[model samples]
Target: MTDAQEPRRARELGIVVGSLPTGPHNALTDVPGVRVGHTTVADPPRLHTGVTAIVPDALGPGRRSLPCGLFVGNGFGKLVGATQLAELGAIETPVLLTATLSAFRAADALVTHVLAGPGHEATRTLNPVVGETNDGLLSDVRARPVTEAHVFAALDGATGGPVAEGCVGAGTGTTALGFKGGIGTASRLVEGWTVGVLVQSNFSGTLTVRGVPIPADDAAPVPEGNSCMIVLATDAPLDARQLGRVARRAVFAMARVGSDFAGGSGDYALAFGVPGGAGDTPPPDDAALDPVFRATMDAVEEALLNSLFTATTTVGHRGTAVAVPHERVLRRLREAGAIPR
Candidate 1:
C-alpha cells in the first residue's frame, strides 16, 4: 500500500520547501475555519495507535476560543493543554493529537466533545488541548489502544479539506529520520495571510532536505520517545504573543530537517490564531513580523518533508519503518540540482 499511490507530495518531489505561494489545498485546511481529522489504528497483535483532530473556528459557533500558542521546542512532551494553553492565551477544544499512553484518552474525548456542545450548558473550567508523540518504536507502547471511540471518530470526522498524510491519524506507529514517519501537511501564502502546517513525524535526525543530507539508515535503529508534533494554523490577526512568535518559527523549521535536539526529544510547537484577541485588527506590528517569520519557516520545512514524503513502509509492532525511498529520494533530488535533471 504505497500510501495508495497519490502520496508523492513534497512539491511532487522537486522538493521546494519555500518560495511562499501555496494555499489552495496545500492543507492545514488552508487556514480559514481550519479543520483536520483522523482515526487510524492499525490492528493486529499490537494495534498501532491513532486519533487526531484540530478545528479552530473563528467566531460563529460554540467551543470558540482560538488565539493559542505554545512552543516548547524541547521540553519533552506529554502536552495535555500546556498550562491552560499558557494561561489563557486561548483555545477551547479540538486540538487533540494522540498516543503517549493515549493522552488521557484523548483528553477524555476532548472534555466529552466540549461538554457535548450547544451553548456549553453553563460550562465551567475547560482545557482539553491534547498532544503527544511516542509511538513506542512501533506501537504496543504497553497496549494503550487509544479509545474513546477513537476520540469520537476524530471529533466526528473533523473536516474542511485535504489532510491525510502518511500512516494517518496521530501518525500511526510513527518513526522518523530513520524513516516511516507520519502525517504531514503544508501551506503558505503570507501577505494575503494563510500559513498552515501540520506534522507529527516521530523525530530523530539526519534526514535533511534543502541543505541535502537525505541518506538515512545509518545502521537503522533511531526511535525512542523521540518526539515532534508541530501543528500550526493561521488566519493572521495573531496575538498570543504573535502566536508565540509563530510558535518559535515552527521549531526553527525543525533545524532545517535533521534534529539534534534529542534528549529524548519532546519538541512541541503549537501556534494558533483564527481571529485573535480584542479585535477587529491588531497583530502585525514588529516590523510586521518578518513576513510572518518567513512564511512560518517555510511551512515548517515543507511540513517535515511531507512527513517523509507521505510515508508507506510502516510495519509496526517490533519495528519496520522503511519508507523514504521515493526512487532514493528521486535520486537525491536529481543529483543535488534539487530536482529536474
Candidate 2:
C-alpha cells in the first residue's frame, strides 16, 4: 500500500490514541523525506524480536543532511556509532534500533547495508548508529536472533507513514513500567513545522500518561533494571550541539510523566534536525543558537508525549498480558478536568 494509505489503516485498526491530530502518517516518517521500516522475528518458543530502520534521506554533495545530536541521561546503555556522529556532526547512513544483546550484530549489519547502497564509496570506516533495549522477557536474546537479513529487510522496506507500534519491530519484546510497552511515537506542529518522536519502551518504574500514574499491580512487576531509547526528528534546523540540548529536554518530558531514570534505566535521547537543501547550518555563535534550542525542547517534549499516547497494552510470553484501557484513561482525564468536557 502507499504511504498515504498507512494512516487510514492505522485509524481503522484503532492503533491511534489521544485527541490531538496527527501528521499525515502520525509517525516520524511523517516528516518529509524521512523513511522507516521493520523486520519482525516471530519464532515462537525461541525468538520474538526484530529490527527497525529510520533512513533520514539520501546524503551527497548537494543533498542537505540532517543535523543530529545525542544525550545520555543515565548512560548505562550502549549506543553504537554515536561518538563519530557527535564529533563530525553528520550521519551518512540510516539509524537502526534492535534488541540489546544484538547491538554488535546490528551495527555490523548496518555497516554492510550502507556499503551495499548505491553511491557509497570505498571507505575503511563506516559509522552505523545502532540503539537498543533489553527484550529477554519475551525473546531468547542470547540466541542472537537478529541477523543481517533482518537489518536489510528493515532498510529495504523503509517508507514514510504511520509506523507499527506496540508488539512490532524493535518493540516486539519490550516492556515498560511493568506493563507491556514496546514502540510508540508522537508528533507536533510548531509554526507550521513538524517534530516527531519514536521510542523503544523497556524502562522500569511506574509510568505516567498525561499525569495519570500507572503503578505495577501485577504479581510480577518489571524488574528494577530496564532502559528506554528515544529518537526525535524534526523539520527544524539545528546544529549538533543544539540537537544535543534538545535531546536533554526530552528527559524533562519523561520525568514530567514520572520516569525517574532509575539506576538500571538507560534513558537516552537522540535528536536530528531536517536540513533545508543549502545554506542551512546554524550560526556559529552560541547566542544565535537560542531559537534552535527552543525548537528542540518543544519537539522533544511533544515527541515524548506522542510516544506514550501512541502505545497500547500488549500480551506476550507465557500468557502475560497488560493493557492500557483507553476508555478508562480518557474517563479519568475528563473526571480530573484534565481534558475539556
Candidate 3:
C-alpha cells in the first residue's frame, strides 16, 4: 500500500465547509484536554488497517468521568460497549476507532491500558468505547493485524493540536462516496463554546460539498457493506441527553455530504463533553443551545469534506478508490458560488 500522496485539507484549497469560523486548529483537538493519535498499518499482501485513539479528557490518576452520549443512525454495524455507554451516560476511558473485525480486540486492549493506568488499583468494571467501519474492501479483514500493542501505542501517543487525517490510522483502507476515505476532523466555535468532530468514513453515497455535487468518477470502485463512526467533543457542560440531541444533528451533517444511511450501514455518533467543574461557569440552558447545534452540523459536514480532500488515492486488493480531485471539486464550488473567486 503506497502512502497517501500529497494530502491537503479543504481550506488549503480555499474551500470553506460552512459559514462559521473554525477553531484555532480547525480540528477535534481544539477542545480543551482532547487529544488524538493514530497508527496506520500497511503491511503489503494484506493488512491496511490500524487504530486511532481519542482521549476525551486526559484520563489518568484520579480524573472524573466525562459526560457522553451515543446516537445510532443505523444498527447494522458493530460498536463495542454501546449499551453501557448509553446506560451510564459517561466515559472513563479513551475512545478508540478501528476496523470492523478489529473492534473487539481494540476494546480489550483499551481496557487493559486503562486498568494499568496510574489510578486503577481496584477498579472492577471498565468500559472501553470502540467504533468501527468495514475496511475489508482494501485490507484483508481476516488477518486482523491490529494488536494490543497498537492500541496502547495509540493511547500512549495521544497529543493535542492538529489531528492527522486522511488514509491514516483506522482510515487506512476506507472508502467513501466513490473516493478514498480516511480519518477526518474539524472544529467550530459556536457562541463561545467549541464543538469538534472526527469521522472514520467508509460508507456509501453520492458526494456533495458545500451545495455542489461532486460528479462520480468511473475509476473509483464503490465499497460494499457501509458504516461510519463519528466522534464529537466539546468543552460545553452537556449531559447525555443533550449530547444525543447534538449527535443526531451530526447525522444531518453526514446526510449533507451524501450518505444514504442504507440498512447495511451502521452509522453511529458518540459525543462527549468536559464541562468546567466546580465554581467554573455553568453550561448554557437548552434555550441557548441553537448556536451549538448549528455549529455541530457545520463542523461535521466540513469534517467529512476534509476527509475526502485530505486523503489520496488508495489502491488495494479488492479495488482502487482514487482520491477525489480537489481541482474539480474546487471548480464546482466556484461555479456554485460556494467559494469566492
TM-score of each: 0.38, 0.84, 0.95
Q: Any runs in candidate 1 off by more than 4 Å, and if so which?
A: 1-14, 21-64, 67-91, 99-104, 109-142, 145-169, 172-179, 183-189, 192-194, 200-232, 238-278, 282-301, 304-306, 309-315, 330-332, 335-341
lDDT values, one for every candidate:
0.81, 0.68, 0.85
User: Which candidate do you rate higher for TM-score, 1 or 3?
Assistant: 3
Report the poorest 10 consecutive residues by lDDT, candidate 1: 55-64
Candidate 3, 1-341: lDDT as tens digits: 45444678888888776689899999999988899999888975366789999986645675647778899999888889899888988777889999888999998999888888777988998888899998998898878889999998898898999899998999998999988899999999887778999999998888988777796776657765588899999877777788888888888788899888888998999888875621145656789878889999988888888888888777775777788887778788888888886
User: Pick by TM-score: which candidate is best?
Assistant: 3
Q: Model 3: what TM-score?
A: 0.95
lDDT tens digits, residue span 156-184, model 2 = 89888777776678887776666666676
Top candidate, metric lDDT? 3
Shift of residue 253 alpha carbon in model 3, Å = 0.6
List pairs with backbone clashes in candidate 2. 186-306
How many clashes would you count in candidate 3? 0
Ranking by lDDT: 3, 1, 2
